[model samples]
Each structure stands twice: as structure tokens, then as C-alpha cells.
Target chain A: MKELIVLSGKGGTGKTTIVAALAALMPDKVMADCDVDAADLHLVLNPQIRESHRFLSGIKAKVDEDACNSCGKCLKACHFKAIRIKRTARIDELACEGCGVCIHICPTKAISAKENDCGAWHISDTSYGRIVHAQLDIGEENSGKLVSLVKMQVRKQAEAQKARYILIDGPPGIGCPVIASLSGTTLALMVTEPTMSGLHDLKRIAGLTAHFKIPFCVCINKYDLNPEISGQIETWCREQHANLLGKIPFDPLVVESLVAGKSISEYDSPASDAISAIWQKLQLAFKE
Target chain B: MQIAIASGKGGTGKTTVAISLALVADKPVRLMDCDVEEPNCHLFLRPDHMESQTMYVTVPEIDLAKCDFCGKCRDICAFKAISVFGKNIMTFPELCHSCMGCFLVCPNEAIKEGKREIGVISQGSINEIETLSGTLRVGEAMSPPLIKKLRDMTSDAMLTIIDAPPGTSCPVIAATKGADFTILVTESTPFGLNDLKLAAKLMEKLGQKFGIVINKAGIGDGSVEKWCAETGYPLLLSIPFDRKLAEAYSNGIPIIKAAPELIPAFKRLLEEVTQ
Candidate 1:
């Protein structure tokens, strides 16, 4: 099966809008939203959850006050500064990395590591196909782990259904979560706009994809907003030997459709036409 | 006082609001770009005479000569960054959380402290406003450590503005936590409202005082403003959707620079938040 992941180094560049459009266009595909921290694909697809599961990934350290000796060793050993001297030693859950170093250093064995429930994942049925998405709890860490879980679940669903494609909606930035979504994907479609920030971030993410030896293509969203920068982007794409997919014009209907909980493909607009053309080219790339 | 301009969704004008606020502040301010993965503040601020410093994160370096295959280090690691197979032992620097668990657990004292170059922190200034930013090395998985390093480098300016990375996860928390107040920038769309709720929930959990700024206000619906009213999160400012502003932003120009009339609004915003 071919896996296509949509990524944008900069956020709010219409990555979800494009992914949702592809979900409407592609017939045999399972969708996964790897933007676990700020998942938005579901806002358009409106998936009905089939199965829900709690994600228990890392551990958090807790200090038992009764067993604690006020030696302050645990406080001093914590690199995260999670441990503080409160009448006895106290561990701040937010600051704790679950490293268990305090547990090892405690003279009285007061500190213990317990598994943390970082978030929840769900398998759902969308009009397009099966989808796997997740929500990382507020103020929680280990978002990359939750993203991997979602990807693995969606891949399994795709294999079971014998689907031809798995379209993933990736989070913004070139950090841990983005890496988790991009690793080992068949193709990556980077959605960017015509702004300097967009071009700057596009270069950074392209460097990341190239570092992993992953073949990627670029598509400029709202190219009409700045035609000059759009031309500049196309020239850069050509110089870098990167595939320049079709560009979508600035259409207000894109937002109207989103507000009405529909994909641009389901609506009539120039952006919709551009996206359909991009989908056709993507299918060709998948076959190659 | 320190103010962090953040958004759960990307491209919601966090950097634009951050630079504008810093420029309009009455006193000297320090603008910190904590979005290490893809920092964009430098694109607009254009600080002069940039001074750079390499940032590093700690990882365990095992001494093979003194090492025995006890597997203690591997077992204690929560991130599973280290593995012991028969006579072989390996450490994946990318997976390591730098908790120093292996260094503490090694019975033979074989684990030594090592450093990995993750990114660079640079300092420069635009007149009275000093600028600081962190740029992560490409392919680096972690960003919180670099963000933390940048926060630690904050000077004692009367007003400090942080342009936090997009998302409500670790990096966002690292940049936003401990600030006096946070300004959550978002648009007026379904996706924007959804992510803004998540970001607002995070701030509440952290017990951070925060307000909202609705950007691109005229394009989408009024749900964002309605939600703010219902949740009692003060709606501080609204930047209407304008082609001229969009064109200016496309060319790496700050909003205040593009439209000088917005300066008074930003000044009032600074006053309101600082009060």
C-alpha cells in the first residue's frame, strides 16, 4: 500500500483543508491525523468513533511523603527541577520527565515511578473510510509517542481493509511529532503559502525530509495572495529538483465550506479545481 | 513582566502579534522566539549584529572498557534510548530524554555524561528591543530543551515577549509556562476555534492568566468570539482580514509597519495585559 502524508512546516497553511479534500477524492484509503496535539482533520471529516483506547506511554515520578527523609538528595538530583522541598520532598508532575533518577537517588526509597495516561486514541468510521486519530491531554508530554500509536493503528486498519492508500495529516514544525509522522512514508506532500515565513519554513522541512531520504513535493496554497513570492517558490522548487504540484488560488469559499463542515472538494470553487488536479498528479506519483 | 504569544494552530499570527507588541511597548522589551524548530521572528524583526551560541543537551556516553552487560542502564531508561543485547550495548541519542537515569544506574560507573548539539541560540537587537531566538538543528526530534535554554537566557527586561511554537504540547508548555500572562492568537474558523479551545484548556490547567486575540476576524464565522465570551476569556483585540495586511505579511513586513494605525491598538493591548 502507498502511504501519503500531508505536512506543513508552518501551521494554518491549509494542511487539513487539503487532507480533507483528498479524503473526499480518494476512494480506497484509511485516514490518520498525526497532529495529535492540535488535531483538526476530524473537524471536517466528522468521524464517528468506533473504538477508543487510553494511551499509557511514559511514567511520572511521585514522592511518598511518609517514606521520605528530608535529606534533599532527590531535590538536588532532579535535572528537571521537579522535586522541591515542601515540608518533605515533593514532585511537580508537570516538570517531571519521569526519568526515575529521583527514585534511584532517594535514600529512603520515597520516590516511585508510575505509568502516566498521556492521552486517548480512537478508531472511527468516516464517509471516506476508516480513520485513526488521537488527543493528547492538556499539559501532557510525549506527543510523539501518541502520534506513532495513531499511525500504527491506521496502518493496521489499512492493511486489514486492503486499502490502496493511507492519507495522514501531520502536525506543524520539524520536531518529534513531525518526525514520527514522516518516517517511512511513501510520499510527503508539503503544503505551503506564498509568504516569506512559508518559504522559510518550507526550506527547513524540506531539509528534514531530505535528511531522511524521503521523496517530497511542494504545493503552494493561496498562491494568488502573493504572486511574486509564488513565482519565487516555483523557481526554488525547480532549482532543488523538487516536484512543483499545482497551486490553489485564494478562495473565500474554502473557509465557508469549513464553517459548514465540508471539504473544498464537496464545494464549488477554484481551490476545489486546483486540489482535484493535484490529486490526479499525486496518484501518478504513487504509481511511480 | 513576561508575555507569551501562542496559538494551538499554526499560522494564526503569533509571530506577527509578538513583533508588533514588542515594537509598540513603552519601555525596552526583550522578544524571544521560542519556536526553535522553525523560528520566523528573525524574518521580520531583522535584528542587527547577531551573536550566536551553540546549545547542547546531555546524553549518556558508555565506556566500553569499564562496561559490563548488566542491562541496568537499559532497564532504568524510561525512553528506551539504550538497549543491551548479549555483549553489545547501544545508545540512541535521538530517543534519549537526558534524564541521567543511566548515569545514575550504571553499577560500574561506565556511563559518562555526553553532549549533543541540538540547536543554536542567537541574541541581537532592534533599537531598544533585544531579540533572542533558537533554531533547532534539522532532523532533531526534541525541542523543549532548546526552548528551555532560550528561556533561561532571558535578560531582566521590564517587558519580555515570547513567541511560542504552535501546538499545546511540551514545547508550547515549555515556552509559555511561568509567564505573567499569555496571549492566545487564533483566527475565526472551525479549525481555529477547535485548537484555541485546546490551547485555552492547557493554559487553565497550568493556571496561567491569558486572553485572546482574534486574527483574520472577518473571513470566518463568529464562533471564536462567542466561545471566548462563554468561557469568560477576555477577547483583547481583533485584526480584521485585509488584502493589504496579507500582502504586507507576505513580504516579511510587520503588521504595525504595514499599517501604522494598529500601533495604538497594540499599545493598548500591552497596557491591558501588563496591568
Candidate 2:
């Protein structure tokens, strides 16, 4: 199966909206939303969850007050500065890296490491196709791990159903979560806008994809908002030899469709026509 | 007071709002761009006399000379950044969280601290306003450490404005944790309201006193304002949707410069928040 992941180095550039549109256009595909931290694809897809699983990754250290000996060894050993010493040592859960170094150094064995339920993932059925998505707990770490888990679930569903394509909606930023979603994907579709921030972020994320030797293609969203910047982006794409798939015009109906909890493809507007054309170009790019 | 401008959704005017506040503040202000992954504040501010310093994080480097491969260091590593097979030991610096567990667990002192360059922190000034920003090296996964370092470098100005990355995760938390107050910027849309609720919950968890600002206000519906009213999170300001402002933003011009009439409004925002 061919795996296509959509990424935007900058936020709110319509990554989820495009992914939902692709889901409406593509057939025999399994979708996965790897933006675990601020997952919004489920808000538009309206999936009926078929399976829910707890995601347990990484550990957090807890101090046993009764067993504490008031020794400050754990305090000095922690590089994260998570331990505070007073009458007894206390650990800051948010600051703790869950490294278990404190557990090893504690003379009285007062510190113990326990796995945290960082989030949950679900396999669900949608009107478009089967999808796998997750929600990371508020202010929780290990989002990269949660993304990898969701991708794993997507692969399993794809293999079982013998699907032809796997569409992934990725998170913003060129961070751990984005990297996890890009690994081993067939092609990366970079969704960007025509703004100074968009061009700046596009360069950074393009550098990241190049560092990993990942082939990628670019598409400009709301291209009409700034035609000059759009021209600049097209020039940059040509100079970098990065494929420019197509551009989507600014459409107020896009937001209207989002408010209605539907993809742009569900509406008869310019943005929907643009996305359909981009899908055709994407399919051809995937085969190369 | 330190004020952080953050939004759960991306491109909702965090950097724009941050730069506007810094420019309009009457007092000496320092703008800290904590969105290390893709910092855009510098593009608009264009600070002069930029000086940069390399930022590094500590990772474990195995000393082959002091080698007794007992696999003890590999066993204690929580991130699995190290592995041992017979006499060969491997270290993946990218995977390392630098928790120092491997160093503490090594029986033979084989593990030594090594530095990996993660990013660069730059300092400069715009007229009277000082600016600091961290630019994470491409492909670097860890941003919180770099963000923390940037936050620590801020000088004691009368006002400090931090521009945070988009999300409700560790990076966002690291940026806004110690701020006196946070301004959550959002558009008046369903997606905006959804992510705003998540960001608001995060602020509550962090015990941060926060208010909201609605950008592109005229385009989307009024769900955000209604929610803020029902939830009692102070609605600070609403920047109406204007093609002129969007064009200025696309051209790397500050919002205040595009709409000079809005300067007094920003000044009032700074006063109201700090008061």
C-alpha cells in the first residue's frame, strides 16, 4: 500500500481540512491522524470508534513519603531539577523526565517509577473509510510515542483490509511528532500558505525532510490571499526542485464547511474543485 | 511582568500579537520568541546587531578505553538511546533525553557526558526593545530544553512578551509555565473554539491566569465570544478581519504598522493585563 502523510511546519494552514478532503476523494484507504497533541481531524471526520486502547508509555517517578530518609541524593542526581528537598524530598511531576535515576540513587528506595497513561487511541469507522486517531492527555509528554502507536494501528488495519492507500494527517512544527509521522512514508505532502511566516517555516521543514532524505511535494493553500508570496513560493519550489502540486484559492465556504463538520469536498465551491485537482496530481506523484 | 502570547491553533496571530504588544509598550520591553521550532518574530522585528550563540544538550558518550561492557548503562536508559551487543555498544544521541540515568548506572565509568548542538540562541534589539529568540536546528526533536534556555536569558525589562508555539503539549507548557499571565489568541471558528478549550484547560492545569484575544474576528462565527462569556475567561480584544492586515502580515510588516489606529488598543491591552 502507498502511504501519504500531510504535514505543515506552521499551524492552521489547513492540513486537517485537506486530509479530510482527500479522505472523501480516495477509495479503499485507511486514515490516521498523527497530530496527537491537538487532534482536530476527528472533529471533522466524525468517526464512530470501534476499538479504544489505553496508551501507556514512559514512566513518572513518585516519592514514597513513609520510606523517605530525608537524603538529598535524588535532588542532586536529577538533571531536570525535578526534586525539591525540605523535611522530605518531593518530586515535581511536570518537571520529572521519568528517567528513574532518582530511583537508583535513593538509599531508602523511597522513589519508584511507574508507567503513566499518557493518552488513548481509537480505531473507528467513518463515512469515508476506517480511521485511527488518538488524544494525548492535557500537558502530557511522549506525544511522539503516541503518534508512532497510531501509525502502527493504521498499518495493521491497512494490511488486514488490504487497503490501497494510507492517508495520515500530521501535527504542526518540525518536532519529534512530525518526524515520527514522516518516517517510511511513501510521499510527504507539505501544506503551506503564502505568507512570510509560511515561507520561513516551509524552508525549515523542507530542510528537515531533506536531512532525513525524504522526498516531498508542496501545495500552497489560500494562494490568492498573497499572490506575490505565492509567486515567490513557486519560484523557490522550482529552484529547490521540489514538486509544486497545485494551489487552493481562498474560500469562505471552506470555513462554512468546517462549521458544518464536513470536508471541503462535500461542498460545491472553488476550494473543493482545487482540492480535487490536487488529488489527481497527488496520485500521479505517488506513483513516481 | 512576563506575558506569553500563545494559541492552540497555528497561524492564529500569536507572533503578530506579540510583536504589536512589544512595539506599543511604553516601558522597556523584551520579546522572547519561544517558538524555537519555527520562530517568525525575527522576520517582522528585523532586530539589529544580531549576535548568536550555539546551544547544546548533554548526551552520553561511551569511552572505549574504560570499557567493561556489562550492559548496565543500557539497562537503565529509559529512552533506549543506548544498546549493547557483545563488545559493541551504540549510542543514539537523537533519542537521548539526557536524564543522566546511564551515567549514574555505569559500573566502570564508561559513560561520559557529551554535548550535542541542538540549536542557536540569538540576541538583538529593535530601537528600544530588546529581542531574544531560539532557532532549533532542523531535525532536532527536543525543543523544550532550548526553550527553557531562551526563557532564562530574558533580561529584567518592565515588560517581557513571550511568543509560544502552537499546541497544548510539552513545548507550549515549557514556554508559558512561569509567565505571570498568558494571552490565548484564537479565531472565531469551530476549530478555533475546540483548540482554544484545550489550551484553556492546559492553562487551568498549569494554574496560569489567562485571557483570550479573537483574531480574524469578522470572518468566522461568534462561538468563541459566547464560550468566553459562558466560561468567564476575559475577552481582551477582537482584531477584525481585514485583507489589508493579512497582506501586511504576508509581507513581513507588523500589525501596528499596517493599522496605526490599533496601537492605542495594544497599549491599553498591555496596561490592562499588567494591571
Candidate 3:
């Protein structure tokens, strides 16, 4: 089985639009939304969840007020500055990684580690195929862990169902969650724009994919927005021997489809001819 | 006052606002571009001289000669960057966040610290604006560590502007974490509003007072203003969709410097944010 990940160095590059179109093209392929932080692939696929599971990425430290001696040892020991010495010591939930350093250092045994539910993942059935995705609660860290779990569940479902391919819509930027989305993928498809910053971030994310030794391809969305930059990107890809999969023209139908909560392929099949070309190139890249 | 300009979504004109605001700082301003992965504020500011410093993290290194493949380091690693099973231990350095949990918990004390250069921080002065930027090594996995380095280079000033990286992830949080106020630069589009909400959530979660600067303020809809009004958040400044400003940005020119008239608006923005 093969896995392909669609990612962008930055958001608002029409990544999900391409992913949804690819999913529509490959209706038999399993899909997973690894961009747990701001997942929108479900809006297109319209998955009906079959099973959901709580995802515990780490522990949350809770202070026991009754056992508090106000020693301030934990506050001093925490490198993250997660522990604050107020009237009583308080732990900032956002800052705490649940490293247990506070609990271990607390002389009064006032801190204890509790399981933290960072997010939830679901195995769902969509019009295209089986879908695996996660919903991360606002301000909850560990989207990376949840992304990993979602991919794992997708792989399991794909294997059980004997699917030949798994498609993942990844998060933006070169961060932990993006790294997690790249795991166990046969190829990466970077969807980028024609702006200067877009090309710059593409190079960064491309370097990351190369560092991971993942064979990747690029598709320039809105290639006509700045044809000069798009041309430069093509030449650079040629020099690097990296695949420039295809070019997606600036299409307003994309926004129309998105506003209607439908994939371009479903909304206007004729309007997505450029994206269709990208999908074909992707399929060819994998076969090669 | 140190102010951070952040947008959860990319291409939301964060660098534009940062450079423009820095250009109008009545005092000697320092600009820290914490978006190391895609540092574009420098493109606008155009620093004359740059001094670079490498940022390193300490990762666990087990002395194999000590004859201890006891797997203690592997077990203690929360990142699962290391793993030892049946006499073979594997290390994935890209996955390591360098929390030092493994080296601290090793029973045989066989683990030693090994340095991994994550990225580089560059310091320089652009025109009158003192600039510091952190650029993560292309393949390096971690970014907050590098952002932390850039933040440490800031001086106590009347106004210090930070151009934070896009997204509400670790890097953005690291950049805007301790700022006195945060200004979220966004557009009037739906995508812009969608991400602005996420960035607003981050500021609210951190208990930081913040306002919005709507770039291309009349492009698509009034969604940003609607959301801001519903949430009772102030709309600090609005930069209209000016083709001349966009053209200047494309040419690597600071908008405020190119068009001096905008300086008054930026000055007003600074005052609004500080007050």
C-alpha cells in the first residue's frame, strides 16, 4: 500500500481544496485529516463517524491544595515556568507539558499527574472512503500526537479493508504536527502559491521533506498570481531534479465550492480540470 | 512597550505590519522576526550588517562502550526519538525535542549530552530599526527553541515589535508568549477570519490583551469586524487594499518608509496598542 501526504509550508494555499479533489478522484482510497489543529477536510468529505476514541497525549499536573505547604520548590524547579507561586502554587495548563518534573520535585507532594485528554479521533465513513480524523480542543496541545494517532487508525482501517492507498491532508508549516503528518508516507505533495513568501516557505518545507528522504512533488496553486515567481520555482525544481507535478490556475470556482461546503470536483467538475491534472501527476509520481 | 504582531494564517501581512509599525516607532525600535522558518521581515527591513549565532540543544547520547544497552534512555524519552530493543538501539534526531528527560532518568548515568544545532539567529540594524531574526536550519524539526533565542535578544524599549510565525502552534506561542500586547494582522477574507479566531483563542488563553489590524480591510467581507465586535475585541488599525503598498512590498521596500503618509497611521496604531 502507498501513502501520499498533501501539505503546505503556509496555510491558505488551497491545500485542502486539492486534497478534497484528490480524494474525489481516488474514491477508493482511504482518507485522513492529519491537520488536527484546523481540520477542514471533513467539510468536503462529509464523513459520518462510526467510532470515536479519546486521545491522551500526555499528563496534566494538578496541585492538591490540602497538601500544599507553599514550599515553592516545584515553581523553582520547573524549567517551563509552568508552576506559579500564587497564594498557592498554580500550574498553567497551556505551559505544562506534564513532564512530571513538578510532581517529582514537590517536597510537599502537592502535585500529581493526571491524564490529559488533548483531543479525540474518529473512524468514519465518507462518500469517498473510510476517513480518519481528529478534533483537538481549543488551547489543547498535542495536535502532533493526535495526528499520529489519526494516521495510525487510518493505516489500520486501510489495511483491514485492503485499500491500496491512503491520502492525508497535512497541517501547514514546519513544526511538530507537520513532522508527525509526514510519518509513514510514501510521498509528499506540497501545494504552494506563486507569492515570494510562498516560494520561500516551499523551499523550507521541501528541504524538510528531503531531509526525511521522502520523495516529494510540488503543485503551484494560483500559478498565474505571480507568474515570475512560479517560473522561478519551476526552474529551481528542474535544477534540483525535484518534481513539479503540475500547475493549478487561479480559479474562482474554488472559493465558490468552498463557500458551498463542497469539493470543487463535486461542485464543478469542469472547473477542477487543473486539479485533476495535479492528481494525475501525483498518481504517476507514485507509480514511478 | 513590546508588541507582537502575529497572524495564525500565513500570507496575512504580518511582516508588512511589523515592518511598517517599526518604521514609525518615534523611538529607536527593535524588530525581532521570530518566524525563522520563513523569515520575510528582513526582506522588508533590509539590514545592512548581520552577525549570526548558532542555537543548539542537548540530546541524550548513550556511551555504547559502557556496555549498557539497558534501554533506560529509550524508556524515559517522551518523544520516542530513541528506542532500544534486543541489542539494537535506534535514534531519530529529527524527532527529538531535547527535553533532557532521558539523560536525567538514565539509571547507569550512561547518557551524556550531545549538541544539535537547530538553527541560527542573526542580529543587525536596518536603517534605524535594530533587527534580530532566528532562522531555523532547513531540516531542523524544532522551532520554539530557535524562537526563544530571538526573543532573548530583545532590549527594553518603548516599543519593540515582533513578527511572529504563522499558525497557532508552538512557534507562534513562543514568539507572542510574554508580550505586553499582541496585534493580530489579518485580511477581511473568510480564510483570514477563520485563522484570526484561532490566534485570538491563543491570546485569550494566555490572558494577553490584544487587538486586530485588518490588512486589506475591505477585500472580501466584514467578517473580521463582525467577529471582533461579537467578541468585544478592539480593531486597532486597518490598512486598506492598496495596490501601491502591495507593489512596494513585492520590491522589498518598507511601506511606511516608501509612503511617509502611512507613518501617521502607524504612529496612531502604536499609541492605540500601548494605551
TM-score of each: 0.98, 0.98, 0.90
- List model 1 lDDT by residue over A1-288, tens digit each: 999999989998999999999999998999999999999999899999999999998789887889987899888788897888989998778888888888888889888889898899999998888899999998788888898888899889999999999999999999999999987899999999999999999999999999999999999999999999999999999999999888999998999999999988998789999999999999888887
Clashing pairs in 1: A11-B10
Off by over 4 Å in 1: none
Q: What does TM-score give for chain A of every model?
A: 0.99, 0.98, 0.97
lDDT of 3 by residue, B31-93 (tens): 889888778777776698899888898776767766367876776566678988887777777
Off by over 4 Å in 2: none
> Which is the winner by lDDT between candidate 1 and candidate 3?
1
Error of 3 at A24 (Å): 2.9
Global lDDT of model 2 = 0.92
Clashes of each: 1, 0, 1
DockQ of model 3 vs. true complex: 0.38
lDDT of each: 0.92, 0.92, 0.80
Which one is best on DockQ?
Answer: 1
